[model samples]
Target: MSFDQLASELQVRKAASLYRGRKVLQSPQQPEVVVDGKAYLAFCSNDYLGLANHPAIVSAFKQAADEYGVGGGASSLVSGHSFHHHALEEELAAFTGRPRALLFSNGYMANLGTVNALLGKQDAVFQDRLNHASLLDAGLLSGARFQRYLHNDVDSLTQRLSKTQARRSLVVTDGVFSMDGDIADLPAICDVANHHKAWVMVDDAHGIGCLGKTGAGCAEHFGLSEQQLPILMGTLGKAFGTSGAFVAGSDVLIETLIQHARTYIYTTSMPPAVAAATRVSLKLVQTEQWRREQLTSLIQRFRRGCEQLGLSLMDSPTPIQPIMIGNADKAMAMSAALRDKGLFITAIRPPTVPHGSARLRVTLSASHTEVQVDRLLDALDQVK
Candidate 1:
């Protein structure tokens, strides 16, 4: 209740090796950036397709700003629903092959809005143990009987589904685990959700614009029908290189969310210019199949190289490649060693991830060349 209590809390965080910090980036979000007066090739950004600094996206953003101005002055429930937001929703609906889509300010908001809107006191929410923090928080906020199934374990979900007596059920998971770099078993989970009559929602924050043949996220990558993964959440800031998020689903679902989602009802909408820019990026993401191809090749290259160095890596097909360096201190040591070698990567530690699984999350982007990946592999050889 006092300032000393806050200071003591910060001290406890420091002692627990979980104090977080931000780096000052002097350059754009690209393969190479200037951070803290030093230039380094960073592998920590979420810009999977490398369009964060693409000329066309920049031009689109600038042009839209000229036409639409900045900021949505009111919430969408009032008068802030502009043409740009509507168009982006249409584009996203078509992109994900869903009947409708609803926009939220960010992936976090999208998850919270969707989860809390659909399930309340009478319903239950089941989630994968390793789903994103936002999903877990959303479930808690929903006042449902929130339960976490074993990570990516379909049998666990089946057992829980058979036992639960809640009137309505919602099953949630990350299409790709944020920190572990492993994918959820979508096919198995879908089967369980289908058999149990529970609604399925997937937070594909890290999957969109990085998976599928045309960057349609994990549902498309796995060839699952929209009916199979009815509630899909995709963020624009990651692979699309823009800000905001959208939920794609059946028309009834979108209508319900537009009426019921508290986050969407109360908060100001995303800028019209951001929607305009994201529209351009979405087109490029859908048309540019080469980006996913190259990114996959790079992930494979890095995995093979790490294997040769006897470094353990997670089983992931996406851009998130987390090396399994066990101890927190050693993970920090390895991250520092790479930083000194002109490479910038964050040392992921507990509460962001589980203790002893702390390691470097080596993210790949379409902007990075094969040679750059090989150089990274070579530098990592030093750790071996």
Candidate 2:
């Protein structure tokens, strides 16, 4: 096809109900926010712990700014790493019960860097079919024998594992699926990986700082040991209510990444302010257990209310709830309708989700109120 033909194809995407657009947020991360100059009740952020706009985190970030200036100014290998980054890594290691931790610019970088750095060509990488795009992309970039198992199916992973007799095999999965809002069976996956003599990697990007006591993440929530579930990746931008991501594991793992993870070695570290703010967020996630309690109660209330409304909500105990709408048009329409009623939930469509499984990904936060959930349900009732 010619260049003009390729341009035409792009236009067809917009015509075919598949193109996506972003809304500009003009206010802080909160239940009620100003998006594109309009006020709405937002159910779209990953800020489950609601520390994104917390006064303490804000103050800490500002104080760090006063001390450290703006950017890292260079890569860590060349003088970018700071005391704030160092402290955040230590706190992350303790939080996740790991010997050490290393931070990346984002969850995408952490997953890609870790997966690519660990196993390479001729090795085997088994991933959940619905694992994040970052993991899938990492597997491709690593030149590994990438095989996707059925989503959340440990047996499928084992079956694929049985097929591969490579020198290194890593089974990777998302602890909490970003779009589906479903939890992966980590215990079963870890057991299968162990039985097969393979390594397990959990990308608890949305699970950490949201589920477990002390907000340690899915492994802690399931009571799995660090030995049982090594190679854990957590994102600070989500429930941690800050920016960047980290890999938590033994000293060897962190050292290996420090030496070989291209993403971390090459990119400038996250701003010191982010690390400083994350320290504040971590303390709150540890001591302020009431936030978790409130979140749990809200999740239960939302699930029950959705059930009573006969809405098809995913079986998610966490605050990430998905209402499967099945078609892109319907999903987009649902989101638009809800937005019209002053609710700001976004519709997720392919390729963010599977074909024919478009959905409204409704996320909750500790800042959300029962009245807000009830109001969202009311909008759902009218839209449905």
Candidate 3:
């Protein structure tokens, strides 16, 4: 806690080229945005279907705000759970085809609360080594015997699960990994989980509303059922183009979280207006299949372009396509060069990925046109 120690740590980070900074966005979350007073063609957004700025969603937000004011006013158990919150939960349950769905303020809380609620000292929680930081932190804090298997390696997971002596076992993973963008082998993982009698929890934050025929996320993408994958968590802020997150499962699992999840019990509810807006976004996500089509086309175009350019790309079929630049300094330089070309893509540096695998995380959205994608390609060519 000493000041000198803190300063030394910061200096170490800067020296290692691991320092990070935030961009000041002056426009809505879209393909085109103004950052720090400069207009740029942005390619690093999670608004996969591009409903973040859709007129219908905005109108819904405005209308709900007029009716419900701003905040949820209190925790749900105390009184903050309004009609909007209730209705959204019901809609989400139906949307995910689950027996029931419980809403959390955000994805992090949803993960932490659910894991902490389900696992205890005598339980064992096995997670993917590449799972999100929130999931890792939750597992560590859950007071369980936490074991991380090799990333997406079912053999490693099965080996670890078979040796567990804990009373309960849970296997958790990200449906679509946030950084690498590769998908978890959920069906195979479920097969292993079933063999060991361990419950599988999938945090499909990046997969939902972007995958599957109806955008039900990786479970639907792989056709896995509620019984096979019992714990399902998804974030609305990403592909759904809204805020907050949800956990969907059997009625009993949700009731267990409601009774024991400390994060949910202690936190104030997300704004009712946000939930109202999410309802509209959810509907569009289901009915507007054209957006997903357009997004897939863009992703294919970008991948082909990158392949032709000989730029290193990840094996990701989703909108998240990362161009790996091995060194952190080189990654930062590449990002700066793109910015100079009026393309606003961010460099993801070390500690986020492995020390040597810093990358340019290029994401595509349905709001983007082919011309815009071509412009990004041109910028990449010039920069590299």
Candidate 4:
């Protein structure tokens, strides 16, 4: 096939102000970073607890690399499942208060593997309209009867569940809506699912390591038991300052995924070094309550500043605070203006979000100081 159609499609995207570009980070993931050789106060990282470069995690990774080398070298089902991986799985199972946990290469794969492993042509999968792309794609690719309900609307979910006659029904949702930064009403959702005799799964990728008294995530925060929320998926990269993902659930669920999930069965496991480092990161996530406190304090400060400036903000209590800009061009312009002022916040546009709802996604971290947040507010004020 000729490349003419692809070339024209690229041009169309650029013309619509929906084009995306990447900036090279010359430094580590932190508040102050050198991107493409320019220093900027960045607020777009998912390192919520600010442990990406923590000394203890670094040391553990180094030690594990020396012992296990750099790669898994094979799929887990073959020879890649190392001791570090096994230990982390057990730790995660206990952390989430589930009977067992299975590790995946990443959050995308985790969602794909879990959903597909549990559903088929005779099954039904219900997802939130605003779930992460992976979850949506998983539901579509599962060959199940897939339906999307209104975002976090229990009545909508109940109505759909009541009508499905599949052999099995799974209701999936994000513990925290990534872009909007609002939490899922898990309790209400669980109640509704139970009423319909359906299973509930929560992808808490952005909720863990920054939520709950023990940083166990939305499940812990909402006090949902393993039976209440049967399937739980969480990522380590976001707040744990490491890479990979895990699904914690009943023993049967983990075994089912291990036996049937192609994404898990076919892919090489995550490096042992990362698993080792995550063990350390997980400890930090649990023992360090100050990180969550700092995040809460910073979020309040930023929201108060945005209110005073009269900027349209979303109803979010998490680190992600988006300033709503209805036009894509204006949102891009505002992002550029902030960059010019030495602040780096990305403007999220469709099809990542709905059309006419483009906005600047501002993520906070414990590493960010109060002065740095004020500087961001000042830059936003100027741009506005």
Indicate which candidate wins on lDDT: 4
User: Which candidate tops TM-score?
Assistant: 4
Q: Tens digit of lDDT per residue, candidate 4, span 1-384?
A: 799999999999999999999989999899999999999999999999999999999999999999999999999999999999999999999999999999999999999999999999999999999999999999999999999999999999999999999999999999999999999999999999998999999999999998999999999999999999999999999999999999999999999999999999999999999999999999999999999999999999999999999999999999999999989999999999999999999999999999999999999999999999999999888889
TM-score of 2: 0.98
Cα lDDT tens digits for candidate 2, 1-384 = 369987888798777678878779999999999999999999999999898999999999999999998798889888999999999899889989999999899999999899989998879999999999999999999999999999898778878998897989999999998888889999999998998889999999989988787888899999998889989999999888889999999999889999999999999989999999999999999999999999999999999989999999888888899998999999988889999999999988888888999989999999999999999999999999
Residue-by-residue lDDT tens digits, candidate 1, 1-384: 569988999999877767888889999999999999999999999999999888998998899889878888899989888898999899899999999999999999999999999998999999999989999999999999999999998889999999889989999999989898788889889988989999999999999988888899899989998889999999998999989999999999999999899998999999888888898999999998898888889999988989888988898878999998888878888998999999999999998888778889999999999889988998899864
- Show where candidate 4 strays beyond 4 Å: none
RMSD of each: 1.1, 1.2, 0.8, 0.6
Q: Write the per-residue lDDT of candidate 3 for residues 256-294, one digit (tens) a residue.
A: 999999889999999999999999999999999999999
- Relative to the unseen true structure, what is the C-alpha lDDT of residue 287 in candidate 3, on a scale of 0 to 100? 97
Off by over 4 Å in 1: none
Distance from true position, residue 53, model 4, in Å? 0.8
lDDT computed for candidate 4: 0.96
- For model 1, which pairs clash? none
Error of 1 at 23 (Å): 0.9
Residue 280 accuracy (lDDT) in model 1: 92
lDDT of 2 at 211: 79
